[model samples]
Target: MKSIDPTIVKKKTLIYIPKLNRRQRTIVSTVFAAMLLLAIILGGLLISNERITTNLEIRNLSPSLEHPFGTDWLGRDMFARTIKGLTLSLGVGITAAAFSVLIALALGMLAATMGKRIDALISWLIDLFLSVPHLVSLILIAFTLGGGVKGVVVGVALTHWPSLARVIRAEVMQLRSAEFVGISRQFGKASWWIATRHIFPHLIPQFFVGLVLLFPHAVLHEAAVTFLGFGLSPQQPAIGIILSESMKYLSTGMWWLAFFPGLALLIMVRSFDILGDNLHMLIDPHRGHE
Candidate 1:
């Protein structure tokens, strides 16, 4: 056998490797995070109801290869239940967040373009919504609507829009003063026309990032209300319901009941949080300057 030369080994070790800049890194990470969340959503959707069936014979099994997340006291697979619950939560989150974004878009534009009295009224509405804690508002809305998927969705939609609306309002206010907007107005274009064509187009990136960022909050709030008995029904396979059920068995040494479901929820929320942050970074104009 030939002995390896130290100098040749050192030269090979010194070979240059290019490092990704902040923008490139952000793009790569955003893609990965998106794919991971998509996989979880898809997997949860594809899993059948049979996998989550209760069987007292296998009840309360610990985590193992056969049952990755273990079994609940009723012998339902925790993994399946967690995935299903997450998918349901995702549905609610997406629906609520989309509606919330639409609300923000309309109110934001109205407040900026509809003149002083309208602006003041809209601003006051925004302030009023912002003044109340979201949970308190959400609970009231959900309860008044009679507590189910519809109630939860509408409640979350109504409650989550103020912050994003404020951001959009500020952006539109800034855009209203732009030279192109003034030129458009002078050239016989209506305010609405200038807004939809010029200002709204510029806000697409901001709206998309805001939508993505809102998903986690919507999902979390939905779960919270459900846990508090003001959201989804007990029959629904929601994460909140699962958690509420798990509390009874926790002292009985069935730690897996609460542990796995909560962990999965956190992981899903964190994934969206990362995806939104990276996408915002990727699109930001000042990012490269920094």
Candidate 2:
């Protein structure tokens, strides 16, 4: 047989479909991830309100075609419950992450632009928040705030901002010394004007990526607090409550109750994580080559 060159084959393959450049790949992945997330979220929301009814005749059934996620002890459709809970979690995650990012942006801007005393205070606050264990702090906050959806949202929002804030502060501090900023200062532009016009625009990419990165953490923490009975009420069809209710039946081989819901939650979290990472790669110029 004639000698076959792997290089020739590789070149031919590249010619047919041309390997996707980093930017193209990043865009593709980001869009796919975003679409998947949206589908899950919207699908969940569409069906969430329709799942309140129960049927005792089908209670406690295992996974089957007729009842994909299985029937809960209350004869509730596990699929519907899981979807509903996921929708709720997604809503909470988005809200909490947005609030956290806003707080971070404000504190970050303040720390970067204000006097050394203010910078020191903000840095100290960031360090203080970072020093505490996240879950413990979250639990404490949720408990103190009278444990519920609102409490979980607030807890997640408050606890997740420090790292992003530090990043923002560093970025702003660097932007402060940029050539254009100096030119603006020489032109007698006020600090507020420079910030609003220059600094904020540059920070948009960072803010978007950071906000996305905060979402999975918010969702997981919300679910955790709920599971611990410090979040949404048991009456609510939340993933945490579903899992909590499933524990009693695990001894009897009713594993699907917890399994399906937990898997769904894991998938949702992972999707958000992938979406954030892809967005980061898409936005960061240095990483664009990769």
Candidate 3:
């Protein structure tokens, strides 16, 4: 037998490793690290009443050794408010995205598996939703529904599903005609069984990608709606509410109240967006190559 070249083998191994570009690596690291730190901070806040209370002094004290984020105009501890707001914003974004993804998955699966009439109806509904401006529709829905966190979540979820539905529908349509799906059908498996077992596995990566991508949008939408005075109540410590309140004090030189929260929000949104892009690349390396 001819001797195999060790150098060529090493080159082949390197080729198979799927090296991430600089941006991809940075995104992955930033997202993973931020998520971990955020989780730790949130947990600490939830568990430590003293720590939480200590941060909630209601005065616009500038950033000092005692008050890191400075006090809000209401003298509420900016640090506590920030931590609380971060938790709320993350909760809203994740919950809304999850609900939207579930809606999309169910509707998309149904459309792909059912008859032409069902598919047509679903398609029409999706088109109708896509035609409307998502943010405007979210605001309108939230306002109509009494304007609170629940309303904002529901509104964001409802408006967010159509695009995800289209993606899921396309994935299902492709899988429905595939060999494995045909094999499942030939084995006398129920449609739901085949969908749940075989099809869903393939769909999950895409679904996850969609979920991550939806996160930044959901967060931004929540902030925007709240800032416009139609989502979260003014009493809530949401970043948008903080920013909105800061407008009056802009001339008074109390800039840290808005600046730190806004910075935190920006970091979070950017982190999630980068994370989504990295996840897409990791899940579909071929797309990265292109």
Q: How accurate locally, in lDDT, is each candidate?
A: 0.91, 0.90, 0.83
TM-score computed on alpha carbons, candidate 2? 0.92
lDDT of 2 by residue, 231-270 (tens): 8888888899999989999998989999999999998898
- Top candidate (lDDT): 1
Writing each residue's lDDT as its tens digit, candidate 3 over 251-279 gives 99999978888888887787778777777
Q: Clashes in model 3: which pairs? A: 58-75, 58-76, 59-75
State the displacement of the C-alpha of residue 85, model 2, in Å, after optimal TM-score superposition: 0.5
TM-scores across all candidates?
0.95, 0.92, 0.82
lDDT of 1 by residue, 71-162 (tens): 98889999999999999998999999999999998999999999999999999999999999999999999999999999998999999999
lDDT of 2: 0.90
Residue range with the least summed lDDT across 10 consecutive positions in model 3: 47-56
Question: Candidate 1 has which clashing residue pairs, if any?
Answer: none
Candidates arranged by TM-score, highest first: 1, 2, 3
Per-model clash counts, in order, read 0, 0, 3
lDDT of 1 at 104: 92
